[model samples]
Target: MKELRSQAIVLRTMPLGEADKLVTMLTREAGKVKAVARGSRKTKSKFSALVEPLTLGSFLLHAGKTFYTFIQGELLKSYTGLQHDLERFVHAQYFCEICDRCLPEGEPAEAVFHLLLTALETLEVDPHPARVARCFELNLLEELGLKPALDACRICGKSGGPFRFDPLEGGLVCAECPRPASSFPVSAASLAVMKRLLAYGFQKLSVCLLSPQSQSEIHQVCLGLFQHIFDVRSLRSLQFLKAGKPS
Candidate 1:
């Protein structure tokens, strides 16, 4: 049997049989992996907490015919503070879910691994969780080769703003440029904020305060881009997030 040992982050977990769990994780060395954790469903199982989603840990596993079997794990980070906050926790889940959906299994994704780890670490203490999340999403999109051109109009190549974001066309469209029926108006302020979010580091994100209008615009743009590019109709975490909002 082949053994694999690496630092990994749990993406999600599901019950298997009666006492075991099917765990999905993103590892620094192996990208996304689905493994079975024996007896993890039992309260007395030592592996129970280690398999919780959003956890970072070092793990040992043995390859089976169909799946890898987790043998041991050492908790490296639990992000306890993040789990305590509902908004932050849901955002973190959204981040993981995106990675889980986008990345292929067994292919090494070191860049994405670091991006997610850094995002989680930043989300734990960052005053502006939304900025952190936006940055993470933009960076992740770039990593996946789906980055939208935000610098100028996708068609005209002009440097000025007051552009409309067309997710179907994958970039900004100026008034002079042929706009698609799917394109929607995006304010200059919101565009500037998105450019900054994509370029700035996580430590600097706390300084960018977003107005409610700009926030909604940015959210829709990202959501549209994600859905159009990945063919993902919706994210479960996003539904939970919307439901949690004050209506």
Candidate 2:
């Protein structure tokens, strides 16, 4: 019977009992929340468009024993631009999936909420999907306190390059340091890109021109660390993205 009001962005939604939907959302006030929207599947349902994934809105709910019941909501941004391109849509879904799986339920994550919001807004206007994704991933990792040390060697404190990334060790390992079997070499160009991506933030991402090699390397390093720390080996959105890639 407790009322909850917050600014939220829909993360996922699914049909429930025909007329209702089970919705998962990330809120600025309360990390992630799952609620039931009664009659949302109906043609004229108030929540029909309000509960769609990626819609940002002000929401009202009543807390139940197991889930919150959506009372009402006002739409803020639908991010409809994402739907115009298949690649953008898939990337957006991937971003949501990471937040959905990683964020603890009911915990306040204002920083994270803003990070996702900004990332989505950038994705809406930016043509560089790969850059946007990597930026989001790195920033999300940092916000979650799982940020990998990329500045210097993990052991020797060496600030020089020709390094490899060891996800288990959680940073870069210089050539002088002992190599772990899980470590993968990181090219200098890729290293610079990663450093700047972390340093300058997403706004400057437009200026960086990434080669295919740098792009692939950055992806591998971030994905490797992401999987190891989160224990999430597979992502459905990522699979869809790869499957859709033109040969």
Best by lDDT: 2
- Clash-forming residue pairs, model 1: none
lDDT of 1 at 102: 86
lDDT of 2 by residue, 46-153 (tens): 889999999999999999998999988999999766888888888898889989988889999998899899889998888788788888888888888877788899
Give the distance in Å from residue 100's predicted Cα in candidate 1 to where it truly belongs.
Answer: 1.3
Which parts of model 2 are misplaced by more than 4 Å?
245-247
Model 2 scores what on Cα lDDT? 0.87
Clashing pairs in 2: none
Candidate-wise lDDT, in order = 0.85, 0.87
Deviation from native of the Cα of residue 40 in model 1, angstroms? 1.0
Q: After superposition, how far is residue 110 of candidate 2 from its true place, in Å?
A: 0.9
